[model samples]
Structure formats: structure tokens, C-alpha cells
Target: MNYQWYPGHMTKAKRMMQEDIKLIDLVIELVDARVPLSSRNPDIDELGKNKARLILLNKADLASDECNALWMAYFKTKGYFTVKVNSRNGSGIKAVEGAIQEACKEKIERDRRRGIKNRPVRAMVVGIPNVGKSTFINTFAGKACAKTGNKPGVTKGKQWIRLNKNTELLDTPGILWPKFEDQTVGLHLAMIGSIRDEILNVDELALELIKFLKEHYQGCLEERYGCSESGDVVSVLGEIAESRAGRLKGNELDYTKAAAILIDDFRIGRLGKITLEFP
Candidate 1:
């Protein structure tokens, strides 16, 4: 249950986001699909008020398809245009361009009424670190896209990637820190490998993961580690140790190493397409 956050970097990130929020017409947020809520910091609601919002459930490849759909509905209920996307492999990415236009249709109409023709929608991609923001940007703004440098009246130095005739995305993504105040939220983020593993007690985290998978995602451990369908969690760890050859010099089961390997398996989708938090 040990979680460490860098407070100084968080404050600076907030300040930078506040400044960036003022110049954009829309916010395209990226979040891990496996742990949607826990992977997010909703303070963007305050920072991005009065701007259009679109949520991209990044890394959809690592999460269950049904869970990803439920999460899309969940965010839609909260007034966001949401879509499941796997930025790494480009699944569901085509839907994003259309979703962007739909999310900003109102603003585009307003500009049209003012006689501003072909003014591309200005947007910024934002997310917690390691949530595929960079990958999304690289793919969305392809090689043909041009980088629009700083303006005269604008901030000292700003970069914008011109996506198309109708859109321009700010190059620098707004870095938002995850809200670690909730202990469960911290645990979910840690399980996804978003937070460094060194900061957590691997044995305790593995036990927590075992309890969750046993209750909600039954058979995942057995499928991944050849677990014998045991009711005892420690025995499950032993099975994993046996399958993965986790052993001490005395040939004793190394539960700690076994636990670390199990967590990594789940994180990397070897265990299964499991959702840490259900909708």
C-alpha cells in the first residue's frame, strides 16, 4: 500500500495545463482502457471548462471489449464524446477523426456564423503519463502534417501540429497527474504498470490482484500460470512459482519473484483481457 508521488512536478504540470487550456477550443483526453476511472485525473473538468471534450480510451487492446464498451457508455453519460482506441496498433483510430468533428460541431458552427471560413479546430491532447498520448499524437498527426510554431501575440514559444484543413492539435500534451488521494485508485494504477513497480510491495500487490481476479475474472490465473484452481491464494502463488521457475538458492519457492512475474503477466495482457475496474 505504499504509493509515492512527486508533488513538485504535479504543481508545475497543473500550472502549465492552466496556461495551455486558455488557447484551445477542445481537449482530447487519452486514458488507459483497462482502468478507465483510476487512470484519470478529472481536474481537467475545471481546467477545460467551456471547451469541447473528447475522451479516447487508449490501449483498448489490453482490456476486455465488453468492458471498453461499457466504459464508453459510462463516459458518454457524463457528457463526453468517448471512443475505444488502441493507439499502438491503430484499432478504432479511424473513428477518432469523425468523433473530433462531431464533438466540435457547435464551435465550428459558431465560427461559421462569424464568417470565419475553414478555420481548423484548435485542440490539445491530454492525459496521465504513459497512457499512449504520444503514440496517439504521432499517428493522428502523420508525416504530412506541419508544425505551426509560436505566434507573435501568443505565448513566447508554442507548437501546434496542423492535422488537416479542419483541425490543428497542440503539439505538447498537457500532463495531468493522477489523483492518488484514493487508495484503491493508487492500487489500480500501480497494477497497470503506470507507476514504477519499485515503489510498491510486490507481494501485497500480487495478493490484491489475486483476490480481484478470483472474484471478478475467475480462471485467469489458472489460464496464465497453470494454477490448479485452488481456493487458497498462497497456493495459487506457489503454482505460479512452479510454472515460472521462481526459486531460491535452496530450491525453496520464491513467492516474491513469482508475485512480480504474475503482476507483469496481467499488466502485459498475458493473464487475460481483464478490466481492473468494472463500469
Candidate 2:
């Protein structure tokens, strides 16, 4: 299945961000830890040119710790201040303030040289949909400053939130580009719940996920659902359906239900600390 999701609202959001980019000192981009590169919107680079950049790998609890460390090093090599954070439980949230200060140290020094003091650093938080921008903001600010939801597009417009005397945050809606040049990017995004499930063929996606686990994570499927993973992916999925009691009206196995369960399990990290991409 070809995965592409760009609603009309994203166009407006991108335009608004372009206008607001001039007002901020830093761009704090949040990316899914499982599929860091794919979850990032390329438009952000163009919009945030010449701005201080900090990449927060959200949902770090669900991704492999080894891969997370590698990804942090990878982004740091590219000159982006990177942090591995689990926004839900507040694990790595404390390091963000210092990272932000470090990222904008040059700007801070310039302001100091000009005798401008006590000026708060304005930052714009950006990321693709469902990458946990709102949750990160809420957690970082120590209050429910932005609307939080599990689904994408929770923040509809820009809201400037004053966190403290030294910093302020501008929350923008999540936006994806119009087209994905690499279908693998789309597939990885879909698997990580960045794309809406309503428009996707979950069964097909589940098969693709199973294939990936079989190749990279070897006994994941067998251990999770108690299903044999030696056969073809379809047969593996069938075994999963049987093991999970996904049955329909006539007592036949329901692949759709089974697929939904498997996908949800992966999203919630039931299958273990799995990362879809490597540095």
C-alpha cells in the first residue's frame, strides 16, 4: 500500500510557521525515536535556516537504547543538539533546558555583548504528526500548556507559551510534506503511527512489519504472540490470529483484527524496544 497523508490544514500551518520563524531564536524539533529520519519533515530545514536547532527523540522508552544512543551521536555529528526523551514519563526532560541554552549560546552572547539582558529566548516546537510535540511541551513546561492527544494534528494553530523568565515556546501544528520521494520513508512513518490508520490497509502493514521483525529482530513475533515465525509472513500472521483469538462470526480467523492488535501492540511497545531505522 502506498502511504501518503497531507491534509489541507498542513499547507496553512507551513505558511504560518514561515511567518513565525523570524520571531524565534531556536527550533526544537521532535522526532519519533523508532523512525527518527522518516518522522522529520524536510520543510523544517528550509523554514528554520540559520536558526539554532535541537532535536528531541521523543518516545525513547519505546525504542532500542543502543539505537537511541547511536541516533543521538548521529545528530550531534550533524551539529544538532540531540536529546533522547520519554515525554510521557518525564525521563530526559530535565536535560532539554540546558541543551536549549547550549544551542543558543551564540545568540545569548550576542545579546549580552549588546547589553541586552533578561530577554527570553523564543523557540518554535516543530515535528511531524503524532511525534509527541504537545506532550513534550506539556512535560517540559511542567504544566498542561498544549493540547495533548494520542492521534496526530492535535495542535491546530500557533500558541505562544511562556515557560519561565528565560524562555518561551511557540507550539505549531504537525505538518508532513506533499509527497514522499522514498516509499520506505512512508512505510516507516506508517508503522510508527505518524500516518493515520483509517486510510491504511492494516493487514498489509502488519505483514510488512512482520517481515522487518523477522529480518532484524528475529524471535520477536514468536515471543510476543507465541506464534511460530519460521514460515511465510502470511502464515505467521495466521498463527498470530489464532493465538490471539481473533475470530469472526463464523469462527474464522480475522486478519484485520489481528493486524490492528499487532500494530497497536507495536505502537505501545508490547513487542519490545524496537527501532525501525539505524544511523
The prediction achieving the highest TM-score against the true structure is: 1
Q: Which numbered prediction scores highest in lDDT against the true structure?
A: 2
Q: Per-residue lDDT tens digits of candidate 2, residues 68-117?
A: 99999999999899999999999999999999899999999999999999
lDDT of 1 by residue, 207-275 (tens): 899988888888888877778766677888888888895689998998998998989888788987888
Backbone collisions counted per model: 0, 0
Query: Residue 152: error of model 2 in Å?
Result: 32
Give all TM-scores, in the order shown. Answer: 0.96, 0.91
Candidate 2 minimal-lDDT segment of 10 residues: 147-156
Clashing pairs for predicted structure model 2, backbone only: none
The parts of candidate 1 lying over 4 Å away from their true place are none
